[model samples]
Target: MYKLLIRPLLFLFDPEKVHHFTFSFLKITLRVPFISTIVSRLYQVKDKKLERNLFGLTFKNPVGLAAGFDKNAVLYNDLADFGFGFIEIGTVTPKAQAGNPKKRLFRLPKDKGIINRMGFNNKGVEAAIKQLKNNKKKVLIGGNIGKNTQTTPENYTSDYTTCFKALHPYVDYFVLNVSCPNVSSHAKLEDAAYLKELITEVQKINNQQNIQKPILLKIAPDLNTIQLDEIIDLVNQTKIEGVIASNTSVNREGLKTSTEKLDQIGNGGLSGQPIKEKSTQVIRYLAEKSNKSFPIIGVGGIHSAEDALEKLEAGADLVQIYTGFIYEGAGLVKQINKAILKA
Candidate 1:
């Protein structure tokens, strides 16, 4: 129904606008009494066998909604009804910003992929925390936090520290998001030394709190094997909880989308089918390098049960979906969860 009926209608509008409209509609629909129950009945796949614990949090399943979807905390309850094991919200910054200009999100339908330079446009950490404070659901929520674009790398630790403190009370885990390709200076923070400083600072603050939430680093899919090895070592040295194998790739190699059309869409992270193999490769590398000691949350190009299975087999403790949710709709969660159970 979504691919045939709802998606075509939604795709008719500008991608970003449609995203807002769809979430707004969901927010309204989910507010109605008993609507959540009905939605869950239609979408959720219940199985006690699917429950798994990761980073000290109990997830109903291993599939979660990746960050960048609910950048702010809005619509988490609505999304929770759709059967996701958990939801990671935000790439939120210290302050609210409009992000990049219009037409930043582009759909590459031919490639079953998307190119986005949304620049972490979010309502900021405070606003997200306000929404989260009111949230009543038990579903695990991970906060994917990033620095403001204007913040220089010299003071980057402060930006991550501020966001980490603000969201500490609300989230089940933390994903340091220094790898987004959209923001101009954001990718530069992915340097191993800088990342270690940022993660260490956040860990210091988390330790002071009564409850310490597990913190994981989110990395780009574009890194090479040596760089990945450094990251694995860094994870071991930092004692961070885990790694989100990928954020999104800047690579557009081998995309089915034409050179002319892709060139026209230029400069953003490429996600979906084009990223699946590389993401899995990163997972495999991280898994082997860590000797399977560090848990991995795999995210990139998961559009089917097979894709999810490949990541799991390659060594992912859990998997997340972003572009796949766009292409496969709500059923993707149930499908992946079922496949995991079968395995």
Candidate 2:
């Protein structure tokens, strides 16, 4: 029904616009009596086998909605009805800023992918905190936080520290986002020394609190083996909780999209099917090299139960979806959980 009826209609409008419209649509329709209950019954699969206890929090399932989808905390409870075990909100910055220029988001339907240079556009963390405080659902939540666009590399620690502290009480875990290709100067923070310093600083703050929340790193899929090795080493050294194996890829190879149209789409990180293999390779590498020393949340281009299984086989403790959800709809979550149960 989604691909045949809803997706086609949603796909007709601008990708970003459609995102907003769908959120609004869900927000209103979900408020109708028994709507959420019906959605939960249809989408949610309850089984002890699907539970994942990681970072001291229990996930109802391993399938999660990736960060950019619920950039703010507005739709998490509504989206949780779609059967995701968890929802990651925000690549949120400390201060509100408009991300890159218009048309920073594009769809590569032929490739079953999306190219976005959204540059961490989000309402400031304060607004998200208000929403988080009001959340009525028991679904697990992860906060993917980043420095503002104009923040300097030297001052990056403070930005992350600010967000970490602000969101600590609300989020189940925190993902330090330092690998978004859309943000200029942000990738430099991925340097081993820089990452180690940043994580250590955030860890310092976490330890000060009564209960420390798990902190994870989100990396790009484009890194070389050596870079990934460094990242693994940093994770071990920093004692950060885990890693979210990818954000998106700057590489455009193996895409089925036409060159002319892609050129028009321009510079941005590419995600979806074009990234599945690459992201899986990164996860496999990190898990093997580290001897599975730490947990990894696998994401990028998961469009089916098979795709989710491949990540789990390759050593991901859990998995997430964005583009796949866009292409496959809410049923993908149930399919993944059922596959995990069958396996």
Q: After superposition, how far is residue 289 of candidate 2 from its true place, in Å?
A: 1.1
lDDT: which candidate is best? Answer: 2
TM-score of 1: 0.98
lDDT of 1 by residue, 279-322 (tens): 99999999987799889999999999999999999999999999
**Global lDDT of each candidate:** 0.90, 0.92
The CA lDDT at 196 in model 1 is 83
TM-scores for all predictions: 0.98, 0.99
RMSD of each: 1.1, 0.9
Model 2 per-residue lDDT tens digits across residues 1-343 = 9999989988898999999998999999999999999999999999998999998999999999999999989999899998889999998899988999988889998999999999899999999999999887669999999999888777888999999999999998999999998887855777888888888889999999999999999999989988998988888888888999889998988789988998898999998999999999999999999999999999998999999999999999999999999999999999999999999
Candidate 2 stretches with Cα past 4 Å from truth are none
Which numbered prediction scores highest in TM-score against the true structure?
Answer: 2
lDDT of 2: 0.92
